[model samples]
Structures are given as C-alpha cells and as structure tokens.
Target: MSTINTLGPHTPRIALIGECMIELQQRADGSLQQSFGGDTLNAAVYLARELGEGGAVDYVTALGDDSFSDAMCQGWADENIGLGMVQRLPGRLPGLYCIQTDAAGERRFLYWRNEAAVRDCFTTPAAAPILAALPDYDILYFSGITLAVLGAQGREKLLATLIEARQRDARIVFDNNYRPRLWASVEDARVAYRSVLPYVDLALLTVDDEQALFGFADCAAVFAAYEQVGTPEVVLKRGAEACLIRCGGESFEVPAQQVERVVDTTAAGDSFSAAYLASRLKGGSPAEAAEAGHRLASRVIQVPGALIPK
Candidate 1:
C-alpha cells in the first residue's frame, strides 16, 4: 500500500510466537503419519523458506527436553528457522494433535495439549529475558492460538511486550486463526482478540474464522471492524475465492490460484501469511503480496501435511 518497503530498507528480523505441536495425520489406511506443526510455527517455516537469505525468521516457544522436541528443533533448523528464543523445560512435553481430512481436503483436528510446555512460554522464570528481547526485532508475528495457549498471566506479559515493541517502532503482525475449542468460551475469545487489535500493524484474517469468532455477517463487516480499529493493513482470506485487502484506506482483491486437486488443507493460511509478509518486507505492493500468498497457498493444499517439501 505504501509502495515503499513495508519494513524499511534493512533485512527484517521477525519472531513468530506460538506452539508447535507433534502432529499426527491419520491416513486412509488407518496408520498415523508424524510431523510437527502449529499455526505460527507453520508460518515461521514457510516464512523462512520464502525469505531465504533475504531476512531472518525466528520461532519463540517453550519446548520439552525430549526426543520429539529435539526432532522438532532439528526440523526447524533444516528449514532455516532460528531457535535462539526457544526454551526447553525439563519433564515437560509439546502438545499433540491428530489431523483427519475429508475427501474434499478439509481437515479436522483432535488435540491433547493441556499440559504442553509452551503453555508457560511467557510465564516461566526464564521468560523475562525473552520478553525483554522481543521488542528488538523488526516484526513480531503471532496468532489467536498464541493468545489462547498463553494463559492469562502469559497473555498479559505478551500484551505488555507488544506495547513495548510498538513503542520501539517494531511492527506487529497478527493472524486471526481462531479455534473455538482453544478458549473457554466465545466471549473470552472475543475479549482476548479485542485486547490485541489496536496494537496490530497487519492482520491476516480468514473470513470463516472471523465470522465464527466475532459473528461478522460477511467480508464487509469484517473489514469494517478492522477499519474501526485503525489497523494499517488487513487481508481477508476466503477459501477458493479472492482475498480482499484493506490497506492505507483503500481496498483491493486478489484471486486465489486455482488448484487442480487438493490433498490436504492444513497450513493453507499459514503459507499464505508467510509469503504475503515476505513479499511486503521485500517491497511488493499489497496486491502483489496477496498474489504471492495465493501462489504459495495453492501449492501447500496439494500436499499431505502442514508443510510441503522444500
């Protein structure tokens, strides 16, 4: 929208905050395929791939000192994602989830994460320094799941860090990846989302999720809400339809790339958000960024997991 680089001239430093669960995808043959994925972590990996050597992408979350955790870290490292902000707590474990996909590629998830190590990501004794360091990055990326997982105290710390980060001129990017089961109630979810809206520089929203969370009637209502909050940029992603964007007081739409077939819909939005941010940080216009998002997302849905092969 600005036409100039969205993150200034330097290569941006980005930190994505959320959990990365041990993902188990149930196959048609009744076996489970294992991997690691979560909203922000999927975005982090895709962002790292999209940015390549042009920028830095780091993942900030607490993990357990276990074999699965070690494997998750190694996988991220292979994707060129930085783990400097990751903490390993003893005797704890990462969350686990099973993905079941329908014939049309839509996915449903069953989670077991009540005791995940990342639940204390921002409240542990070792978290003060991490919170203090968050403001130094060029951009902070997170999602609604990040808010949900980080209990009340942890969310407060994150909000404080976001405020401080904004004061220091860092951009805050948010994805409204809403899952009703993650919150105690719809009202509670609404409260948490409202608390962070005013601080966001860019918001990547899926129409269905917004509608489910805030009860917005349509895309128009969704945009109106973000406009009222004065968010600088907002992108509304509609599955198989054009993604509408509002930036700098103007709106634009970009159609999604048509895919011949979809194997799994996991991480579709995550890949899109990552590519959109990557394009913007590299000086592309909002429309161009949306096109980039659509391109990457089209490819992701053809794969069986949250991450396609590099």
Candidate 2:
C-alpha cells in the first residue's frame, strides 16, 4: 500500500523537521566526546545512509550563523542530506547538550537549549518561504521533540503546515520521541500531540513513552488510541524485544537482533525509525521495514552515541 503520492516522476523527497544540537558524551575518566545530534536529525542521518540513491532526504531546521552551526551543516552535507530548507538565523546559536550514561549504557541528557535558534524555527522571517515549500515534498517526517522545540506560535504554524501537506497527498510520519522536560507540562505536550496525530499516516511509537504521555494502560491501549486517530500504520518498539507492526489491516512481529553488550542506547529508537521509513520508501512491506529498523537499531546501540560512524 502506498503512503505518499510522489510530487511527480522524480525521486521521492522526504523532509525531516527538527533540531540538531552540539552533543557532548561524557566518558568515565571525565573526558567528553563531542558531536552533533537531535532526535529527528539522527533519523535524518540514518535515513540518508539507508536510502543513499533510493530516494532524497532533507533536514528542515533553523540554526545560528555560528561556527558550530557551520560544522553541523558540513557534517550533514557529508552525509548527503539536503540543506536547502535550513534557515541560518543571525545572532542566534544552536543548542548544546551533554549525555551521561549509566553502567548499563542507558543514557541521560542535560540540555542547554532554552535559547536555541531552532526554538523559533517556524517563527522566523525565513520560515514563511520554507513552510511554503514543505508541502510539496512527498513525505514529511517529524518527532515529538520537533513539536516540543517549536513554541506556541511555531506549533500553530507547523500544525497548519501538516494539514496543508496532507491535503496535497504528502504522507506524514511521526516518531514518539518524547522528552518530559521539553514541554511546559504533560498537558501541553498531550495537546500538541493530539493536534498532529490525526494527520499522521504512520506512527513509530515507543511503548513506555506512550504510557507516560497518554497514560496508555498497555500496548493494546496504545494501538487502540492510534487506531482511533485513524493512523493506518503503527509500529510499537519495546526496547530489546520483538517490535510489533500493524499495517494495511494486518499485524506482524519482527524480532530485534540481540547485542551482547549495549554500549549506548542514545539513538536506538531514532535509528530504528529512520531505517523503517527508508525501507518503506524503497518499496519494502511493513514487515520488511520492521526488520530493517531492528537491523539498524541493533548496530546503533553497540556504538557510543546517537550516530555510528559511516
């Protein structure tokens, strides 16, 4: 079943909308490994890696005209992700964050993003043109974090954009990468999520986050809620367990590849979402896409950060 109608006979273009931050991964000896990462950005990178020439991918976000921002652009370019939709806001700066991991490689983050340029991504002067162009893409992908970063005005703009995009037959894909600290309150986050869920065609969800955010009693409840919203395809990822997928009125299960030692689970879910979307874009069935998702995410967690080396 096709999710998106391609703009034309050209390659399918998917735009991932979110932020990229300066990431500092803390080591045991007090050393820090620095890089650039964000939920949708991580998905952008991996999706690009997965699709190389199979499709086209673009990252839509706002960044400062700073050196770090320059480096981030350069890095994205190296991965062949499109920068045409990026906004370079003068006098603003990209946000920064540090990651700390427990012995089991579970990670926690400390953010310095209150003033990040991306907070006004859809509110900036350049945003009007970008928003105008966004609806033309074959697919529009974003995350819960994307919603959180965009303030009230930006969220309204984004909500309108999503509606317009879908009206043009662009498929909407959403990943539930919820971070409690990002929103003003649980209620605010819930409102933002509900505003967008009805437009989503495919939902990549984390079981626990759904439980926490919507108080979903269990996996069944989560699926019922998404089904009620009429999300045609839903993939539920329960870390280290078999992922469940319901698409085209059928259900499937894909077992994740086991890792002996989980190094860092930073981008596990993001990477999974990327590979799954890439697979679908490349004509794989929902079941095959889930397999691709598990394959990539298995490799991601064995690495030290959100992104593994190409």
Candidate 3:
C-alpha cells in the first residue's frame, strides 16, 4: 500500500543484496561460454535497464580480489549498477555455476558455491559499514536465495538490518526464489522465509517455488498465506500462465505473453520481477506492471542466458 509517490519527486535508491556467481553455459557444440549471473544480480541488471534514469540501482555483495571479481564489478558498473557497497575479500573467491539447457530451453544447474566469499558477506569486519549503510536506501530488495546463501549468522545480521530499514520507512521487496539444494532442509527454508515475510512490503513470488517450499495446494492458498502475513502487495508468477496480483485489497490477473520459440528459460522470472518492480517504482498500476513483467519475461525466455542485450 506504500507507494513510491509518497517519497515525492526524488528518485528512489534501490539496493539489492545477494551473490553473483561466475557462470558457465554449455553450448550445443559441447563448448562453454563463461559469464556472470545470479538471481538478485540478474534482477539488478534488468531492473537497472528497466528503470534507466528513473531510479538508481545498487548491488550489495562480497566478492574476491581476483580477476573474475574485478570483471564482475566492471560489468556491473557498465550496466549502471552502483558498486559502492560491494566488498572485496583477499584470498576468497566468488561462487561458480554451470547451466545446461535442454532443447526445450528448460535449464538445469550445477553449483560450486559452498565457500563463496558472499557466504561471509555480513559476517566480515568490513561488512559493518555496508550493513550500517543499507538502512538508508529507499528500497531494499533481496530473495530467498539470499537467505540460503547467508547461513544462520549472516541471516541474523540481515534480519536486524531489515528491521531497522523498515523502521526508517524503506520499502522491503522479496522474491521467493526457493532453491532446495541451498538449504539444509525444507523446514529450514520455510522458517527463514516466514521470518522475512512480515517485513516485506512487496513480494514477488513464483507460484511453483511457493508450492515446492510450503506445499501450498494452489494459487489461492498461496495468496491466502501472504494475506495472513499482511504483505501489502503480492504478485504470483506462474510460468506460461496468467500472473495473479493482489494489492490494496483487490486482485488482478495478467496473461503471460506467448513466445513461439524458447531458446533458454534462464532468468525468465528474474527479468519479470525486475520489470514489475521498475514499473511500480515509476508509478504504474499493478495491471500495467504485470504486463511489463510478462513482456520482458517473454523476451528473456527467447534468449540463451540470464542477461539479454540492452
């Protein structure tokens, strides 16, 4: 219910917290194309593109002092994402993941990320300043993947920051991108998700992920649960189906755009969430925003990777 309009004419400063990994995409010829991608990072890039000069998007995470990390920082900068809050740790490296796409464009992933530098992001001594500065942003965005990667201690610190950020009137946005392999158990993921739900102002939820994580019987059940949590705005994304939105005590459904050929399904949801949030930030209604989300996602699924060309 809280609108960016309340903040007057000032451009919103958005900070997205999570990890960006070194990405390897296996090609049809059996070669590999190396790039960078992650859930929140992909959202950050697309959000920046969607918002353009309408807002400021910053990425908050820790990376290594290595060349890959350096290239990642430069790439984010080229995308117009702020790097002021990024931390670089010596002798540490970022995570890596490989994407294998079938002929149908559905993706399967292989990860090597247990010891990534971002796991210690909020636990590091240098992180104190970044954590302290996080509460000042106009919007603070993160995802369930952030919860899984941060572990218990880092999540505690992040929760404390979210509490303070909410108190300072920063709108909290959450994307429920539940990854089973990232958490120790399903119960652990549920607890972490429930802990953050109360603080979220706008929730960008994937219906399939919600069902997998909470065993919700259907979309109605998913919306009912978020209603109980008092989330002001909720968008339920169902791939290839209509996206349902509940906001301001009303509901709306926007049909997903049809795509003839699907090259890769990577970043489809991330791109959708970014476009939806960008539209809302720019004063579009829920219906308009969902349309924007669908349009972007349709294009994204036709691409080969997480980020499409500007």
Candidate 4:
C-alpha cells in the first residue's frame, strides 16, 4: 500500500562500500559511448536519486589522484553523493571496462581492472582512518563484487568492521552480485560470502546469480540459506518476472512492471537493490520495498546503459 510519493523521510545515513570504474560501451553501429559504472556505485547513485535530499548517502572507495579519478569524484559530488571517505592514492588510476551487447540487448563486460587502484583500498596505510569512520553510519551497503576486489586480507579487515558496525546497531545490507571472473574460484567466493552472512540484516539476491554461484535450486533454497545465516529480510529478483520477498515470517510476490522495450539489461539489479533499500530506510514494508525496486528497475533497463540519465 505504499505509493512512491507517500514515502516518508530518509534521514538514515548509508555508506556504500565499493568501486566505480570507467565504462565504455560499444554501439550496434560500432560506435562507442563512454561513462562510469560499478555494481555498488550504481546502487549509490540510484539510491541518492530515489531519496533526493531525504538521506545521507556516502560512497566509500579508494581512487587514484589521476584525471579519471578526479572526474569520477566530481560526478559523484554532482549527484550529491558524499566523497569525504574516498582515499586518493598517489600515482594510481581508476579501473576501466567495456560493455558489449548482443542482438538481444543482453550484455557482456570486458574488464581491464586487475590493476585497479581500488584493490588496495582497504589495505593501504590511509585505510585505517577510513575504516574507523564506517561504524558511525546508520547503514552499510556492499556486494559480492566488493568482497572479490578486496582480496582475502582486506576482506578480513572488512569482516571485522561489519561485525563492529552491527554491534553498534548499524544495519548491514548486502547484494549477492556474483561475478565469477572476479574470484579465483567459486569456492573462494563461497568462503567470503559465508564469512559475512551472519552480520547481514537485508540480503538482495538475484536468482540467476545464486543458481550459478551456490547452486540454489529455487527461491526456497535461497531463502533457507539466508534464514540459516539469520538474515531477517530476503528479497529475490528474477529478471522480467515477479520478485519474491520473505520478511516478518511471511512471503509475498511482487510482479515487475512491463517495459515496452528492453534496450539494455545492465544495472537492472543494481537499480532494484537501491530502490528497495531506499524504501526500507523510509519505513516501508518488505513487500512495498520490492514494488519500489521493480518500478525503478523497469525504468532502468529501457535505457541503454548501466546508469540512466537523471
């Protein structure tokens, strides 16, 4: 029963922890479109757009003191996303990737990110101060991609921070965005994911990714896995179909809005995760949040890239 306009204040502060990379897209006619994108960064931008001035959204990542990094920071500031915690390492550069779409508009990405500056984000000497400030936020948002990028030692530090943050009453929101290529093997991702599950309050899962990563037979299996990890809210997104929600000991089905044309499916899940979290921060129920998710994702896929123009 929640209308988008009826949503209340979003004063809660959320720190989105991840990387943003330079994005280049190949058009059907062999032209190229340049932009910036990353899973959690997309979520941060969409979350800010949905909340407007209602909430405090900070993007936590490390960038180099290069022109591309400078441009990226300026763009985030233009979107009203906080960059105070972003570290600028000397002589390093941001990551880059290219997107190519099939005839069906389905997308594949080629990354040049193995040497991205963000890989050392949490392990750098400057990271001590940044990690100290994270627990002050009302919510902490991250994804599997964030984990993969942080590497093992950095992830250990992050896991400790997540535990401390939750102990201080901050809610943890996680998205299961499994990019297999980012990790050495599926077992590595499984270990990283398991280490963080017990502290998660809300988990946004993509059914296809879960099936590919964890071999979850269905939504039921996904729900069961999270429940065992003590996650109270679980939202499942199945592309083009209804999303499933399990919260407060009850489950609900929220259908996605039908789009006339699907230009590109990139960032569909990222946008949905943002809207859903924004709805929750505004005090909407899980069912209502799922509806908000679908509303935003429906609008996103109709556009050509991971980020749609505001």
Candidate 5:
C-alpha cells in the first residue's frame, strides 16, 4: 500500500460532522435487513480507510445513549475513527430509515428522523467543547444533510465554527448531498448553502442536486457559481457519466468506471468524495483524484449498502 505524509503544521486531522441512522433494507421476500448509514459517516469511514494512519479522521455527531448508538461508536472506533467528539444525549434516539429498491436496482429511501438526536447536536451543552476543538483540525468535512439537521440555531453555531476554523487555515470540504425532504423548502436550503459557501475550499457537487437546489441550467452555471463563491477546487459528479472538475485554474472531465451491475447506489457520491479528497490530501492532481473517486464509487455502487464490507 502507498502511504502519503501528513500535510500542514498539525497531524492532519479531519472532522466529518453529521448524523448516522439505523437503515433497514426491504428484501424481495418481504424481510428487512438492519444496517446503518449517513452521508458524512459514510465519507468518514471511507476517508479513514483511504488515509489509513497517515492522518486522523473523526466523526462528529450526536447520538442517543442507546445500544444502537453504542454499536455505532464501537464500529467507528474499530475503523480507526476518533470518537472523543461524538456527543450522546440523554433520552434521545438515533433516526431510522428504510431503503426500497426496484428490480433495476434503483433505490428510494423512507426516513423517520424528524426527532433524531442529531438535530440538537450543536445546541446541547456537550456541543460546546466539540465546537471549540473543531478549529484545531486540519480539515473539516460536512454535507448538506449536516446543515439541514442542524436547523437554524445549530447551523449558526456551525457556521461560526467554520469561520474560525477557516481563519486558522483549515481546509473545508463540502459535499452537496441535497435531499429535498430534509428541508422545509428549496429556498431554505439555498439560503443555508449560500451562507456557508465562503468558507468552502473544496466542493464535491452532484449535477442533479445542483440543478435541483440552485436551479442552475447546466454544469457551466454550477462552475460559475462556485467560482463566484471563491472555492478553489470544484468537482461535479454525474452518475454513470463523466465528472467535471476544476482545480488550479484548469478544468478536466474524468469518466466514470463502468459497472456491469449496480446493486445499490447508496453511497456512490459519498465514496467518490472521500477518495477524491483523500487523493488531493495526498498531493495527487485533480484529474488523478477524480479517477480515484470514480474507481471507489464504482466499487461501492456494486454493493448493497452505504458501507461495503472491508
């Protein structure tokens, strides 16, 4: 295996902040297989696995003090992810969801997360310490789902943390994983996203999500918007098609890896973002990083869940 030295002054720590939920998959025989998933958590695991001990990866989120939450923490620890920042709230529970797929392997999700513990992650007393320590990380990673769950006040706190972290020269990586059902309206999501754009150093966007959220006519508009936000690196992912990337004042299109069969598309973008960021943090060029993203995402989509077995 190839190893890349850590970047920046510190030990190169990455904090991925978001919620993880229990996932149930409805099988063909009417059975349900219990699992767990979240976009940021998925990226955290993949990033930790990709970085291997070259850098530290931490998953920052709130969970209930239940057995399921305990198992989630244990799993993250086993994967070499730091747990010191995970907040556990009393009398709360993690969210749950079910994945149903069609014969063609296209997937749809049904969520029961309105009252999930993570919604108050940044508001709880324990969140103070975590937010205070966040500025020390070398990189801060989060998704649109993270923003949505945080709501107004929590998002305000998180945005402040991002500002402070950016002032310390920490790189911010954002993935545009937009779920319309998660927000009150598209306008709300647009406002929330625009508010955080100034702090983003790298953005991993999906073409469809961008179009849906911001109403961009095409990829050019997406790139223009990111450029306006002053983000130095931008990668736009289009499922089964080529991904467009802009870095260091240049642009390139990297084709996706062809998969014979796609069992589940759960973590395709999350896995891709992980590999791409991992490669970039290791000093690979944008084109090389996009290829790495495609390779990992292709493998992930061939599997059945957000997390594939190692």
Candidate 6:
C-alpha cells in the first residue's frame, strides 16, 4: 500500500459513534464492580490512549443527565477522550449490562438497555447539529452494535451522514462486533450491514462474528463479501490466531502475541481496532498496524477490564 491517501488529513479528528453503558462485572468471588463500557466506547478510549498528539478521538453518544452519566463523562474526560459531541438528555438514562466470564476468559453479557438514551441519539432535535457536524471529521468509526441500537430512523440519518462524509473524502472505519440479541432478526441485520459496508474505507472483522452474522463458510467468504463492497482495507481478527489483512491487492498475515494467562477477553477486538487505526494514522503500514493491534489485545486480555492502566 502507498501509506498515504490524497484526501487524508494530517493529525486526524476521529469521531466514534455508539453507546456507553453502566457495566457491572461479576467477580469470581461473587462480588461485583461497576464501570462504563461499550464496543465503540472501548475503541474510543483506546484510540485516545494510542493516538495522543497523533490524532483526536471523540465519542458521539447520548446519555441521561443523571449522576451516573456525569461520572461516566468524568471518567472519559480523565482518559482524555473528547466528549464535545456527546449529548445529555434531560429525562433519559444510559443503558446497563452485566458481564460474566468463564474460566477460559470467554465473556457473556446480560443487557438491560432497551430504554437507553442513546437509542434516540440521532432522532432528537438537538441531534441536527451533531449530524451536520459529523461529516467534518477526518475519520468516522462505528460498529454493528451501533447500528442495532440506532433503530431505523437513526440509521437512516447516520447513513445519510456517512454518504456525505465519504463525498468529502472522510475515511469511514467499521468494526463487525455483532451481538445477535440486540437485533430483531438476522435479515434486518444483514440489510443494515450491507447498506453501510459499501461506504466503509476500512473494516475490522472477527471470523466468528462473520460466521454468526452471515453464516459465512470460512474466512475466504468473509473476504469475498468485503471485496465486493470495495473496502480498501480489511482486517480479520481471529482470537489467538494470526490476523489477515487485505489491502492494495495484497494480503498479509500478522500473528497475535501469546498471552500466558487470560483474565478477560471483553474488549480484545475493540482494543485491537483502536491500536490498528492509531498505527495507521501514525503512518504505519497495514502489516505494522495489524501487529500493533495484536500487541495491545494481548495485554488487554491479560487484564480484567476493557481498559488497563496507562
């Protein structure tokens, strides 16, 4: 790959759109610790940590004016994540979820998010400015869970914004972190994914998620679908295995770092995505970015939470 794009901007401003919920983690001793997390939120924090002066990472979401939401914003601010695009609805509240992990570090989630404030993130009157401002960013990042939460109208608005952003040469990045329970039906999910895939410049995908979403036979099938959409850069993340990257008619396999003991795999892919994009924005080759992604994910899995200490 050339490592430079004519329309790409230096010191990029990245807006990551999604929800951040009140996350409760069940400890092995039956105790629980509360925190804030979501697929895109995790990526946003990691991106902020990785990019520093290289770029600015902002989170775009709506939350209640409650104290929990206030604490959440404070936490994000502490991480140096920009919250200028985040909205606080007077009567709304953020979603909630509980994470339970097995001995193998595999995680399962139980969600109580149906009435979260973010579901209307793009539908409120105040969202007009946010929507209008979206195209101004240098890079836009989102995930499948973002789509599921937005519903029909929000997705339509987001789609329109993405189209406009692409016309202005803003690079769009997508992560296929699919959660089936969040979607009403598989067909609906497929349609939403198809609508956005063509507009994405870089796609971060997991082999297992692709299989669950599209019933893809193998990695080749996943790559074929992405190739059809003309996504210029694609990274296929396989837990504990080499990640495959396709770019500029070439493919690279980057091996993941080996972790001696795994504590949690909650944000493995999200952390990887953030590091990969940060590396790319810093002018690293796709192969180098993939390695960077794997390196960060290795450490994240060794920790008990989505974010580790700086």
Summarize candidate 6's per-residue lDDT along 142-261 as a digit string, tens digits: 999999999999999999999999887789999998889989999999999999998999999999999999999998898888888888988999999999989988887999999899
Winner by TM-score between candidate 3 and candidate 2? 3
Clashes of each: 0, 0, 0, 0, 0, 0
Prediction 6 TM-score vs. true: 0.97
Give all candidates' CA lDDT scores: 0.93, 0.92, 0.94, 0.89, 0.91, 0.92
lDDT score for candidate 1 against the true structure: 0.93
* Cα lDDT for residue 222, candidate 3: 93
Give stretches of model 6 more than 4 Å off: 1-9
Error of 1 at 216 (Å): 0.9
lDDT of 1 by residue, 63-144 (tens): 9999999999999999999999999999999999999999999998999999999999998899989999999999999999
**lDDT for predicted candidate 4 compared with the true structure:** 0.89
Report the lDDT tens digits of candidate 2 across residue range 261-281.
999999999999999998888
TM-score of 5: 0.97
TM-score of every candidate: 0.98, 0.97, 0.98, 0.96, 0.97, 0.97
Candidate 3 Cα outliers beyond 4 Å, as residue runs:
none
How much is 15 displaced in model 4, in angstroms? 0.3
On residues 203-266, what C-alpha lDDT tens digit does candidate 4 reach at each position?
A: 8999998999999898899899888887888889998999998887788899999988888999
> Which prediction has the highest lDDT against the true structure?
3
* Models, CA RMSD each: 1.3, 1.4, 0.9, 3.0, 2.8, 1.5
- Single out the weakest 10-residue window by summed lDDT for candidate 3: 1-10
- Model 2's number of clashes is 0
Q: Which is the better candidate, 1 or 2, if ranked by lDDT?
A: 1
Per-residue alpha-carbon lDDT of candidate 3 for residues 182-296, written as tens digits (9 for 90 to 100): 9999999999999989999999999999999999999999999999999999999999999999998998899999999999999999999999999988889999999999999
Superior candidate under lDDT, 4 versus 6: 6
